[model samples]
Target: MLAMGEVHTGLLQNSGEISESTCRQVLGLMAGETVRVSRRPIPHALSPERLTGVDCALPSASRSRIRGVGTVVSRCAVTGGRVAQGSSYVRVVRSEADRRLPWSHYLSRPGVVEVLGKAKAADLAEGFVGDPAPGCLDMGAISGRFLDLVQASPLLDRRAPFRIPRTSLRWVAETGEPSIRFTLHTEQERTLRLTHPGPFTPAVVDLCEDLATHDWLLTSLLIIVERARIGATPGAQAVARLAPAIDHLLHLWMPAARVEEWLRPFWESLERQPGFTRQWRSLVDRVRDQIATSTLALLSAATEAGRR
Candidate 1:
């Protein structure tokens, strides 16, 4: 069995962190369903899971023709009332019959897609992480729609504190010897391949969400620093450009904060190679130095004016 998912992360449209009640109202995607909330570590709220019907060709590395039919599961999450994420995933399994099933049959098994023909897990995984051709299952688009729903809510002011592009992470997991590999593709895209010893579970989904959240934080901060033009721009001007990072993005560098214990090792391994926190700390320090230097310059000018 193989599972694939994608997550889209971006800043909430609200100017400031929103309240729990507001989060619930914004993420109320399903009628009569309660949004799950967890207060510890951070204030997080999750919309009830919704399913979307999909019948499309499954991409294969070997270029073989394969089709899958089922429903894709999706949900929206709000973290600290500042960041929003839309996550979608579907499990791939072999079908006993080689033809399309009834919509009710597919709906009965939410989040599970049945492949109608021969296929290899490795090929599908490779094709998904690699460039996918047109007409293949598009989980990224599905995830984006859910995110749009929350961002378009009338309750929100539609004014984000900062203007930054969203980031997407595509991941595939299969049961095997325990292992994980995460790769950063182009600027706004990433992919992950994992092999777990136990059966696939929802905790794996949680792990992916945590990774995506931290990855987004890192990406947003890097963009902010680049925009500041630290050395070329004037000290005060650079500090002004980076002020949003300190206010909205700096404290969100908590990696594995919401990850399950069993999946913590995956995050630890990633840290060693990529050194996510190491780079984040360096950027944070640089921002702080710029601010301090600008303050000192202002003080010096004030003193000189008084003396004159």
Candidate 2:
């Protein structure tokens, strides 16, 4: 069995974190489906799960023809009422019959895709992580549509504090000795390969979402600091450019906040190698110092003027 998914993370297009009632209205993707909410560690809400029918070729590294037919499960989530994520995944399994079944047959098993022909798990995993070929299952597009639905809601003012591009994380997991490999492909793209000891579960999906959220936070902050041009630009001007980070992006560095205890080790392993929090703290401090210096300069100028 294999689980593959993509998560798109970005800031909510609002002035500040929204209220629970507002979240309910914005995240209500389907009728008769309750939007789950948890208010403790952080205010979070999830839209009801929705499925999209998919009958496409499964990506394979060996160029072997592999076709899959099934539905892809997707949902929208808001964390701290500030961050929005659209996550979609499908479980791949061998079909009992080597032919295309009726759509209803596939719909009966939501989020599960049955491969009609021979396909190795390794090949599928590699193809997904590597460059995607044409006509392959486009989970990103499905996920993007769900995000678009939430962002296009009239309830939102569409005034995001800053214009940070959405980041995407593609992940594939299979049953084996526990192991995880996360790779940052580009500025806006990341990929992960994992081997878990037991059966695949939604807890794994939660773990992926958590990782994507924190990675996006780190990436957004780094972009803000770079654009500030601290040494080259005037102190006040640099501070002005960094204001968004202070106002909207900082204080969102919580990692593993929603992850289960069993998945803590994965987050820990990522911390040791990439040092996500370490880098985030350094950037936060730099932003604060710049703001402080800018304030002092303005004060000193005011005092001199008074003396004159």
Candidate 3:
């Protein structure tokens, strides 16, 4: 069995960080479900899990037609009332019966897609993370719509402090020897492959979401720093360009904050090799250095004026 999912992460379209009350109001997807909130490490809000039904061709590496029918689990998450994420995933498993089951039957097994024909889990997994064919299961598109829903909330003023592109993280997890691999394809696209020792659990999803959040923060900060043109532009102008990152994202680099203790090693492995935090710290220091330099120049000018 393989569980594949995608997370679309970006800044909330609001001028200022929203309060918990407003966060709840914006993430009120279902009528009766309550939005979950946690404030320990930082303020976080999660919308109730919603299901989207799909009966489509599951992507297969061999180019064979494999049909799957089930519901996809999706939810919206707000971190520090600033970052918003829309996530969706489905578990693929072989079906006992040959043909499709009734709608109620599929609904009973939420987030689990049953394969109706002969197919290898590896094939489906590879095809999904690799270039998926047209008319295949499109988790990215589904996740994007959910994120758009939250971004389009009437309660929000749609006045984001900075305009940055959203990042998409598509991940696949299966039971096997423990290992994890993360790949960055383009500016807005990333992929992860995980093999754990036991059955699939929500903890894995939490781990992926936490990684997605921090990855977006890093990517957005890099963009901000590049656009600042620190050396090319005047010191004051460069400092002004970096002001948004300082105000919004420099403080949000808490890795594994929401990941379970058992899952910490997965994050640790990536940190050791690629060093996500190391890169983020370097960029942050540069932003601060620019601001400090600009401040010192202003103070020196004031002193010179007073002397004259």
Q: Top lDDT: which candidate number?
A: 3
The TM-score between candidate 1 and the true structure equals 0.96
**Cα lDDT of model 2 by residue, 113-199, tens digit:** 999988899999988888878889999999888888989889999988788999999999999888889899889999988888789
lDDT per residue (tens digit) for residues 1-308 in model 3 = 89999999999999988999999999999999999999879888999999999999998888889999999999999999899999999999999999888899999999999999789989998998898899999999999999999999998899898999999999999999899999999989999999987899989999999999999999999999999998999999998889999898988788998998888999999999799988988999999988998999999999999999
Judge candidate 3 at residue 40 and give its lDDT: 75
Candidate 2 deviates by what RMSD? 1.4
RMSD of each: 1.3, 1.4, 0.8
TM-score winner between candidates 2 and 3:
3
Clashes of each: 0, 0, 0
lDDT of 2 at 264: 85
Candidate 2 TM-score, C-alpha based: 0.96
lDDT of 1 by residue, 1-308 (tens): 79999999999998888899999999998889999998877888999999999999987788788899999999999998889999999999999888998898998999999999899999999988888888899999999999999999998998787899999999999998888888998999999898887888888888898889988988999999999999998988899899988888887677887888888888888889888888888889988988998999999999999999
TM-score for each candidate, following the candidate numbering:
0.96, 0.96, 0.98
TM-score of 3: 0.98
Report the CA-based lDDT of candidate 2 relative to the real structure: 0.90
- lDDT pick, better of 2 and 3: 3
Cα-based lDDT for every prediction:
0.90, 0.90, 0.93
